[model samples]
Target: MEIIGYARVSTREQNLDLQLDALKEAGCKLIFEEKVSGVKDRPELDKALSYLREGDTFVIWKLDRLGRSLKDLVYIVDCLQKRKIAFKSIVDGIDTNSALGRCQFGIFASLAEYEREIIVERTRAGLQAAKERGKLTGRPIGLSEDAKRKAIAAKRLYENRDYSIDEICRILHIGSKATLYRYLRYEKVRLMNRRNK
Candidate 1:
């Protein structure tokens, strides 16, 4: 029954030394470490989970280091319980192999899932209400009037053959090559429509 540990830090600037030291102290022979945000999937976490056998124990320095959301934490722990692999959160004092830990965690997981559902329902209601009120949700307005004018300028600059696409983009303060190409296409279509008319 090996004790495998996983450690995570959200950004490149953060350090994992403290968590690593703790895991080493806790008798973790093998530890996985990664610098990744909890919101995004961590490849190292998957690797660590895969390394565990049915009887092996998975160790983490803290619960938050494992997951950003309570729902995520509960789901992961549930999976471990089903696999009969023990889980230990050193900071939270949770050990799934124990009867008390199992009972308390079940309650915690249910509460977390319940809260997640409530949050989802509220967000959906809010979006529906905004749509009814004719207020734009999701991504805000894309192209501005100034951007439209710049698109026109981009077309002219490209046809003139004096300035490069990069030069035109720099002149217009366009951020990406994709956006520049899109603007150029929009202008091309507009010019064609005008000629056809």
Candidate 2:
């Protein structure tokens, strides 16, 4: 039976040394390490799961190291159980291969799921409160009024035969084709409104 360990950190700046060392001391025969955010999909984690077989053991330093959500943890543990493989989280003292460990895992998994649901509910409440308060969040407009004015002038110059689109864009210092097209479309809509009036 192979003892496989997995260690992961959220970002490149975070270190995996401690987890790796602990897994090694725990007698993990092979260890997989990846620097990836738990918030994002982890390709290595999927691969590690795919590599498991009956009678093999999977180890992680902590429960959160495997996954943060209770649903995620339960899903993983359940998958391992189906394969008749064992799982252990060193810090959390969770082992899913044994009877007592199995009972504890169910409790831990339930708690984890509860915690995740609470977070989701709280986030929804916060967003609803923000909306009620009329507080706008997220990135500000990409183009300011002054930039719009410059874009309009440049587009007009191009349309009037005073300059080519490329020359006008270069003179205006607009960096992208998309920006130029946006300004052009804005001007077209303005002209259409004038015609309708």
Candidate 3:
């Protein structure tokens, strides 16, 4: 079985010697190191995970070095378990090969789930409060005055038939044929409303 190590520092200015030395002392045959924020994508971390095989031990100097949050950490560890690869964190004293370590990870998984549920509950409560207050939520209903003027102009240009749909959009600085069509529809509805009145 191979023992592989992964080390990371948040910034290029930070030294990785501490983590690297710890991993080397722990007998990691192959080590991958990266200098990147935990919240950002780490190509070296991805490479290290891809390099790990069944019966391999994925070692890290500290738990935070592996993931940005508890949820992310649990997900990575869960994937490792499914792949039959062991995980070890030297400073955190976590070893997936041990029963206590597995139990600790299980607690982390549960806490992550609880946190997600709480967020959903709070969001629902907020939406309900807004509804009770009769405040409009989400996108506004009508176009601005500038858009209405554009719609009127688009309709006039369309009725004249002097310009192609592409030319009309270009003349009006509209982004797409779809946006031009929407403007045309809006003007048609406004005209119909006026005729009814």
Candidate 4:
């Protein structure tokens, strides 16, 4: 049986040396390496999974390294078994060629599913609580006070007829039409207050 190893890291900054070394010691004939976020596209992983044939063994350093999500791990293992490919994890000491390994996987898969359900429940509860408190959770507004000030100054310059809008924007280093519109809104608010007074 051909032994193929797969090693993955979540970012370009992480080293694959340790996993690669372990796979090599485990006698893998070929090792596939990928530096990608596990939550997203995993083309290399998909290819490795597809390449498995009957009697072929897929090896990895650890189960967690294969995937962070339990569902994904279970799916991959299930596919390998369906194709009659053996699966092994060096650190977890799991070998699909044995009866005990199958039992262990069943238990681990159940626990993983339970953990995911709990995570979903907790996240929904937290979001509901935050909604009750009128708290917004997402990307914060990017404009800082200094940036807003520069936009306001640019608007004021144009309003006072001190400088053309283009010239003021050039001086303030704001190049986008959307940003100019924001400034215009700020100016309109001030203009309305002045008129009221």
Question: Top lDDT: which candidate number?
Answer: 3
Candidate 3 on 1-197: residue-level lDDT in tens? 99999999998788999999999999998999888655668899999999999999999999888888878888999999999999999998889899998898888899989988999999999999999999878988777888898888989987776777788788899899778778888877332222111
Clashing pairs in 4: none
Candidate 3: regions farther than 4 A off: 162-166, 189-197
Which of the two, 1 or 3, has more lDDT? Answer: 3
Whole-model Cα lDDT per candidate? 0.85, 0.81, 0.87, 0.82
Q: Deviation in angstroms for 194 in model 3?
A: 28
- TM-score quality measure for candidate 1: 0.62
Best by TM-score: 3
lDDT per residue for candidate 2 within 151-191, as digits (tens), equals: 67866776576565567678888887567767777666342
TM-scores for candidates 1 onward, in order: 0.62, 0.57, 0.85, 0.58
Segments in model 4 whose C-alpha atoms lie over 4 Å from true places: 116-197
Query: Candidate 4, residue 20: CA error in Å?
Result: 1.0
Candidate 2, run of 10 with poorest lDDT: 188-197
lDDT of 1 by residue, 1-197 (tens): 89999999998888999999999998899999988655677999999888889999999999989877788888888898898899998888888889988987999888997898999999999999999999998765556888799888888876776777678778889998678778887777342312111
